[model samples]
Target chain A: MKPEYDLLVVGGGPGGALAARTAAEQGLSVCLVEKRPAIGVPVRCAEGVGRDLLTEFMDPDPAWISAEVERAVLVAPDGYRITLEPSMAGCEVGYVLDRKRFDRDLVMQAANAGADIQVKTRAVAPIVKNGAVAGALLEQQGSVSEVLARVVVAADGVESKFARWAGLETAVPLSEIETCVQFLMTGIEIDPGATVFYLGNEVAPEGYVWIFPKGDRTANVGIGISGKKCRSGSRPIDYLNRFIKSSFPEGRVLEWVMGGVPVCRPLERTVADGLIVVGDAARVSDPITGGGIYNAMFTGRLAGKIAAEAIGRGDVSADGLMPYDAGWRSSKLGMALERNYRVKEYFITLSDEKLNRLVHSVSQIDLAQFSVLGIITELVRQDPSLLLELRAIRKLL
Target chain B: MLLIRRDICGYCGCCVSVCPQGALELIDAYLSVGEDCTGCGICARACPLGALEVADEA
Candidate 1:
């Protein structure tokens, strides 16, 4: 779209689009590019977000929201259900979105803010000068061109090739990566106001099965297991197929999709000289639940704000961008990721029997003033050994 | 060699991120293998669609 700009954003997901919009609103030139011909077409996510989290980026528009979740039901291996009411609202009890319109809406907002937007444009390589990323070589419609900028925002989703090209080690290990598959199923009986999760090693193996209802009779039925657990006869799709047969035999499959989610720590360094990485590319998805829409928008906005400040000061070095890194790491989102990663690692080690016992114990009680400490107290009363195990992990925090 | 059945592949970028060798690329819904590939089969194992395979070059 332009020979050069103050900032060039690679990828047009929530993160990239918000970055471009925020930067452009700050009076910096911006261009956002997406490799896909259309935005959010293949809909890889479960499309669930918290009510407050969605509001942080943009007001929840009914045009994009498919469902408003009011509660969550955690199904144990033995079919014991633990229902978390609205008081436990911090989790995914919020909105199931139609990401097709949601992603496009963010890009449109960026365009309205004076940022140039281009789809079907892939950033093939980073244009490095003096060992700092200056811009990228973008290819579109079988033609290639260079777009140079003072700062480059890498929001290229899970592939993250742009960050890799800029010399960042963006590869995720099999153990940390979650191999996922989901089917949009209709004609399935589902509670229109509740999101359900089935947990246990037998169910997902280091992950869980999610049923996010889109309407009265349609839902996103999905499973995400650790990549290390994936195999020929028991891959993610295999698991999903089995679960569908058992749970929703009469359901009609409307669509099917598969992808990977990085359920690991964010990159050690999210910013380099003249470059900032955001969203799944930075591995900012929630380590326990694999949710990322909020994290992406948060980091994208922060990156834009910080990059604008850096440009104003005429400094785009890693040191200049270090505040962006430090800013997010110290934010509430960063703290939660660090905390949940440990919890995820511990949960995967729990046997199905143990999970059932724990779920049964928790379901027997009513959490009046739900809090982490209260939950820990409740858990310790049920299983004393958990206290020592939690202590071992808590010391690290 | 790493064989990619483009038909079976969903091109979700799963293999590209899991390759220990950083040898696979998902180019606009197409999987591209770079020379850096050692045929370690990590991507094959990580692919949810079972679209990738490590085999003899011949």
Candidate 2:
């Protein structure tokens, strides 16, 4: 007899693992599945997280942190550099994770929490029964089996089909999706405590290039470009190759990663009958930064807790899962996403001249009392009409 | 009317999801462009790596 699970979480990333662990901790029987033989292989992220936010959720494990960033460097098209020293209270990032270890540790936590983990097991499709998701048909090692669950949590990343399979509108417009490529390069002389960003259309064509240092001599050098802005038949790899040739000619590429990020507003509906989508599957990433780990964990934690409660009450319908959606959107994480998306949409269309001007203006701002309002004020000083537009954004946010 | 940069395609299946006509499929890690494609350019536009394009073959 196939063992029935009260909660089944798919993907095994931070969101899925955390959700499974959270539910199991609440005394719910949970099963977590990962298609990969191990988690976090062939890492696709640049892997930087705000220190304060990371610590707020869980204790920072020594094994997971590769480097601690203290400064941020932004270079404009003309090679004008703007250095920022983010205060402890601000949204400055502090850690660049060793992604492999970080992801494995999360899965380990889930396993320790008593969730049945099945690595190398793929969830082929949701088994809908009686008009709601009953379980999923899973395939592993040439064998197929059914794992029934009262609720299914889809924590799959941006490329997930589970949400759509469960009858949700998960389509992302071209303009809102970022095609990304990353190379873990070694032998580069870079500050391990500084995160670098190169911004310009010529640099990434509607996106930016980043170098998040993992250690003194190695970093994750990457580019993320808007899908629609790409020229006909040109790959991000072409741009990345050119950037590498110019910037880090001596850097040795250790690994190559290719993926897409959906940088849009959270889906209007993350919950359907007996199913809830969290993380990138729900487009919970920050549109401006394309960072989803924090939001994923936030939504996952809440979804697991809420799902456990719903199952306890014997109501696992869409209505029962609505509270998870409401709780996540009402938190600070939701507020940041809402505001960032507005800012990103407003600024993404800026021309090269305007972008250079903006970068130049940002360089001139004093960091002694850095704040969003102060930066906006400085930007308005450079381009007076921006004051009015920014005011509109403020109102919307 | 569809141009695929076969060498550049990363086989991410992002295009498969955006194809309105269901003309794209990832078979064994390879992109299989079907005859049902209408040259709507949605797949080309949605491909993150810019691996697809619409050619003026008409």
The TM-score leader among the candidates is 1
What are the models' TM-scores? 0.97, 0.91
lDDT of each: 0.89, 0.82
The DockQ of each candidate is: 0.83, 0.38
Worst 10 residues of 2 chain A by lDDT: A368-377
Clashing pairs in 1: none
Q: Ten-residue segment with the worst summed lDDT in candidate 2 chain B?
A: B20-29
lDDT by residue (A1-397, candidate 2, tens digit) is 2468999998888889889889999999999998777888657688999898888778998898989998888788888887777562353868999889998998888889999898888787899998899889888988889999999999877767677778887867877888888899999988888999888888887788999988879999998888777654455777899899988999999988777788889999889889989998898988988888888888998999999999999999999988998889889998888888888887787777777887788757766645454555677777787766677586753
lDDT tens readout by residue for model 1, A1-397: 9999999999999999889999999999999999999987788899999988889888888889999999888899999997888875243459999999999999999999999999999999999999999999999899999999999999999988888888888889989999999999999999989999999888899899999999989999999999999999889999999999999999999998789999988999999999999999999999888999999999999999999999999999999999999999999999888888887776777789877876777655556735433454566678888877777455543
RMSD (CA, Å), each prediction: 1.5, 2.8
Off by over 4 Å in 1: A87-92, A364-377, A395-397
Model 1 residue A110 distance off true place after TM-score fit, in angstroms? 0.4
Q: TM-score of the second chain in each model? A: 0.91, 0.91
